[model samples]
Target: MTATATEPSRGLAARDDRVATRPLAARLLSRPEVGSLIAAIVIFLLFMAAAEPFRNVANVGTILYGASTIGIMAVPVALLMIGGEFDLSAGVAVTTSGLSASLLAWNFGLNVWVGILLALAVSVAIGAFNGWLLLKTGLPSFLVTLGTFFILQGVNLGVTRLLTGNVASADISDMDGFASAQNIFGSEVTLGPVTLKITVLYWVLLTVIAAYVLLRTRVGNWVFAVGGDAAAARAVGVPVRATKIGLFMAVGFCAWLSGMHLLFQFNTVQSGEGVGKEFIFIIAAVIGGCLLTGGYGSVVGASLGALIFGMTQLGINYAGWNPDWFRTFLGVMLLLATLVNMYVKRRADLR
Candidate 1:
């Protein structure tokens, strides 16, 4: 009887040991986002300590507002990166979507809502075309997206000049449905002493949804498999083409949403706007732990990366530094984060 009782106790202790160690082991294996999270915290504290205005409630809202716009796109871009692809056109696509809406409504006398819907369709179709061409041509995504980026950029400029006789879209603030759209995309909410833009809510919603899809779904598993090894994933019956196409479309969808916010908030969009923002999106993703080689990253990490960007951008201004140095700071952060991510990934691989 004593021997049997001890046997059960031993088994129970073993089970408990596994239960305790499982999460730690999993965390060790999933260390890509760890570095970014730490970086974000460190940067936040650094800014707070050095810049008094950075700690103000209103300023906190400003930081988040800036973060939201970038974070909104970064989430989907991170997922696309995890799926082993790039969307270089993503930035200009925002302009395309906004221009589509603004020009469609202003020039054609269509309702603002109608223009918005048309823009959504056009953006999604553009993304689908990119994915389709990538698969059909067996071309590098960077090259394929670069082509689309230029095409869209040219269209944005050429068509805006042709239609508006100007480099910017006509103001749509007085159009039907403008007010409602603004309320959805550009409105602000006051919470106690802080006012927050609606974009923050959109950013949070997208992040949460993306995290769920990445962590808790079969499709998410397919994303990892495809990114890690597309051939192997295909051999195992993953829908590789469909997944890639879907990811591009996801980027397109995000671009459209962001464009809508831009249009509604300002009631106009520069035809040349969003030209270089794609690099920012990719940089944010890279800083968040998404590998250039694909197959490893985190949505939360990307969000944190965007948070770092917002804080740094505004923090510099609060510190009375030259705005031109922001790009220099981004380059430094990119290099440092890449090194840290590589080290973390190496350690994880060794284990």
Candidate 2:
């Protein structure tokens, strides 16, 4: 009995950790989004107390609409950052996508769908190109994407001028397939008392897909591996190149979708638009639990981050505060969030 009891106890102690359940606190701390979630709740409560308009059910759609726009881009930006890369060009890339599609559809008199399809191809290719270049040259992604950002920015301006003789692309509202495209990308959906832009639905769907991929799929493992340590992952047979490149393409694809929303909604393209927007996307991802160091993040957290932004941005206005202080407020939130995330990460690591 003594021998048998000791053997079983030893076996239990040596149980494979892969199948072992972590303590609840450890598990909770391990989630990147928990800190952000708490922050979001705090902010929401503060706004609900300070601003009567914020408490109105009618404003729910407006808040979600704002969140969805940033959330859409935040999802992919979170993924790319997870893969240890940055796309500074992401902002201008959205403008490029809209401008390209609008210019082609109008100038050629082709169906709007044709330009959209072609733009998809171009956008994906641009992402692939960024990946390929990074792999070949071994330069930092920030540098590579920064160059692309400037190039695309200039092209957006120069080409729009060249084609339309104006700073913006011609309105494609009357083009063939315009209505259909608008219905798909720009329409609003009514949900009982709240009506929301289609992007809200898209944002939620994208987050679900990204979380599923990051958690359930082989691709997700590859992403974590590459981000954590590329050289080590490569030695272990991870497709680092493909994974990183694919991540860039994902960002490109999201940028395309966001651009389509802008295009279909407004029926016009502003060449100078979207500049400085990449930082917002990055900040959202960072707030969501993605570290600047790469390899650790949560898509759910990122979406929540976008929600925080939406609430803060609109809540200030609803509260009758000076909107000019928005930047300062954003800075405060970012700093607080970073500190909270860092403390959470350290606690998780200790556990």
Candidate 3:
């Protein structure tokens, strides 16, 4: 009787894999951000040794500030990709937000806040439209957002010239709400040896919030589910549609924040300023351990990717090297990070 009972218990234990605890190394390897974290450290060491200015404490703030501009959008873009979508219009969308606020407030003699509010609405609506059209037509988001990208690019240029009689938005520094907007969006904060842009704070805040929602909430589960397999997620009663739409709207909201910062920080915005930035955001997401095929990524990883970008950008300039190779370095990192992510995933699965 004892032998029989023991055999049954042994069978159950063998079948129940959770009865065994995974090693700490295996657990860390399973995390999506591990590879990127490793890479970030290596890159930091490389720059720290190679460039003197890159080692300056104040330059840390500069690098963080640069990373923040990209991180602010990259975090949302990372989430959207985790939910299985793209937003090519994201680049021009920033310009659109700034231009919208600048022209609306200047031409109509309204408070800049009014323009800012309206710009937010318009940006969110654009994101909603993208999501709606993708769902209704059963089209890939790539094609949908690509179309949006072109439309917004043309509209940014055409509308800016038509309204402002120039290729840039009017300086709104003298307008009402400009001071508060500057304080909110473009302000700098100093902590001892470091001066940080407000966007950097927002970037960190967004990353923390996004990390919480992704790891700790039901909505986070839905995002992974939809990205892994939308039909399966829907079958499981997950609100796949709403999740994707909300993700896009998040991207839109962050874009508006970035746009406002541009408008206030420079006192004006170039109509063409954001034309190629979408690629940088996407690259940051990919490097941060987000896969090209979706369903796997981390917001923190994306931030690290942005940090790598900022470091390389400033590191090159500081080292007195040709900055032209910046994009080339990014392309290489993207390829390598993709390979590393795939290997890491396989290793995690094996573990």
TM-score-superior candidate, 2 or 3: 3
lDDT tens readout by residue for model 3, 152-251: 9999999999988899988889999899988988899899899998999999999999999999999999999999899999998999889988988998
Question: What is the Cα-based lDDT of residue 308 in candidate 3?
Answer: 88
- Could you give candidate 2's per-residue lDDT for residues 1-351 as a string of tens digits? 899889987897779676677898788877889988988999999999999999999899999999999999999999998889999999999999999899999999999999999889888888999999999999999999999999999999999999999999999898889999999999998878889999999999999999999999999999988988999999999999999999999999998999999999899989999999999999999889988888888899999999999999999999999999988877887787688777777876765
Q: On residues 1-351, what C-alpha lDDT tens digit does candidate 1 reach at each position? A: 999889998888887744556558566545788878888989889988988898888777889999999999999999999999999999999999999999999999988999999999999999999999999999999999999999999999999999989999999999998898889878999998788999999999999999999999999998888899999999999999999999999999999999999998899999999988998898899899899888988888899899989999999899787989999999998999888888888876754
Report model 1's TM-score to 2 decimal places.
0.93
Write out the backbone clash pairs for model 3: none
Q: Candidate 2 at 232: error in angstroms?
A: 0.5
Query: What would the TM-scores of all predictions be?
Result: 0.93, 0.94, 0.96
In model 2, residue pairs whose N, Cα or C atoms come closer than 3 Å (at least 3 residues apart or on different chains), thus clashing, are 288-301
How many Å off is the CA of 346 in candidate 3?
A: 2.0
